[model samples]
Target: MDIRQLARGTVEWDRLERVFRTLAERYDRTVVRVEFLEADNWLSTPCVVDDEWFVKIVTRQNALVHALLTTGRNVGAITSGTGGFFDRFETPLGMVEHEYEATKRMREIGLNAPRPIEAFEVNGLGVLVLEYLPEFETLEELPDEVVRELAPELFEMLATLHEHGLAHGDLRAENILRCRGELYFIDATRVLEDRVAETTAYDLASAMAVLEPRIGARETVDAAAEYYGSSDLLSAREFLEFVRFRPDHEFDTTKLRSEIEKVADLDRG
Candidate 1:
């Protein structure tokens, strides 16, 4: 489907109005109304609301809102004229569709992720509303013990996806949520068509590189290997190799790689 049609097919404005009305009635509190919030050259327009929840309208040419609606995070949402790789590619609605499909496949495999509530098209926009998760922090901010306890399960989830020929385009710590002693994967955009081993390996390695500092290098690599049953899937050395290519602005990755190598060497010896 064309981009506009894809946007309109995802959410129904009437349905959104009904949903908002129901939420307002249930919450019994006036929704905090405000203009769009802009930061870092991005804008999240407040579209609809209730006291505890509201729909954020993001204005961009891409299907980022649709992806978030289907996959459960807003990582793909880009800012116009922000200047980067995103500026060159037309936001493909197919990506949004693929993410939704991936999330459905993941749920079938018993992976932990945010449950998608509903998807609909509203006023030339694709909107997805999901169960709001409260009181959670991204894995990036969690403690090492938490990462050790959590990383294995998440890795297993990734392994399961790989087995099914699926890969999360972005698998960083911030895309993972910790709630009530469990981790939930979010943001399934960039789901590609290829089932190549390198695709899956890169995903695992990238995730390991991003999380190593929080979880430690040895634990990160070991957990991934253990979960995938392949030491080659993401080794400490491979993680270091990949880190060097990452842009300097990726401070977390640069720092974690340094720290993880020190710990990994000690474990090896």
Candidate 2:
């Protein structure tokens, strides 16, 4: 099967069920209503899931789900859930299963993470069933002022994680969510606890990388200070200075100044 079909966001249930049978086989265990989170392709397909059970398929637009499908991989499809969402990857089931375990670990440490319902594999693909979180806005969606206000809270969350011997392997803007005045770190799929200090530094650096740009260096520093009552935490970025995914920390200011001076000299000439 072509991998790209998963991202097209237009797979009908009848066409999708041939390889893996969820509704046909586990009819009673799955949710009856299947909602489509997307609206790209709807061709008189009133309800492919509408059969003996009178089920409705619903779809919700999700960036992570889109990301998984864009790679054109379908390890498994979940035909039942909050809205019948599915995530499949060409990668091994082991990788996806790590996400489930990470979520549980975060939850154990008093951090908010969705619980994993079940996981299965089909056709050499990994399919995960995660608890559906209806509506939560990521830190990426919030305004700068709000981010500044919550900066200390963000730092505290990182501190809590480190204290529990864990690190948010994939700490980024989109993974941190705010719901009803409380912040919830949603995507702990990459959460793990090896090299506690390095991982802790990684989490702090990642959060600061995002916050420093939006709220400026001083306010970001203040946030960290508010958490630990010391500026030491602000320097956590040094531990991950060379991380490829992270932005440079003015590591070349002198070089940048030299180039600027050269351009100025040429313009004057």
TM-scores of the models, in the given order? 0.61, 0.60
Q: Tell me the whole-model lDDT of each prediction, alpha carbons only.
A: 0.52, 0.51
Candidate 2: list runs displaced more than 4 Å: 1-20, 23-91, 189-193, 228-235, 243-269
lDDT of 1 by residue, 7-94 (tens): 4333345754654554444557454442222211111233433223334332243455443443321221212111111111124334
Evaluate model 2: give its lDDT: 0.51
State the displacement of the C-alpha of residue 64, model 2, in Å, after optimal TM-score superposition.
17
Candidate 2's TM-score reads 0.60
| Ten contiguous residues minimizing lDDT sum, candidate 2 | 73-82
Instruction: Report RMSD for candidate 1.
Output: 9.1
Candidate number with greatest TM-score = 1
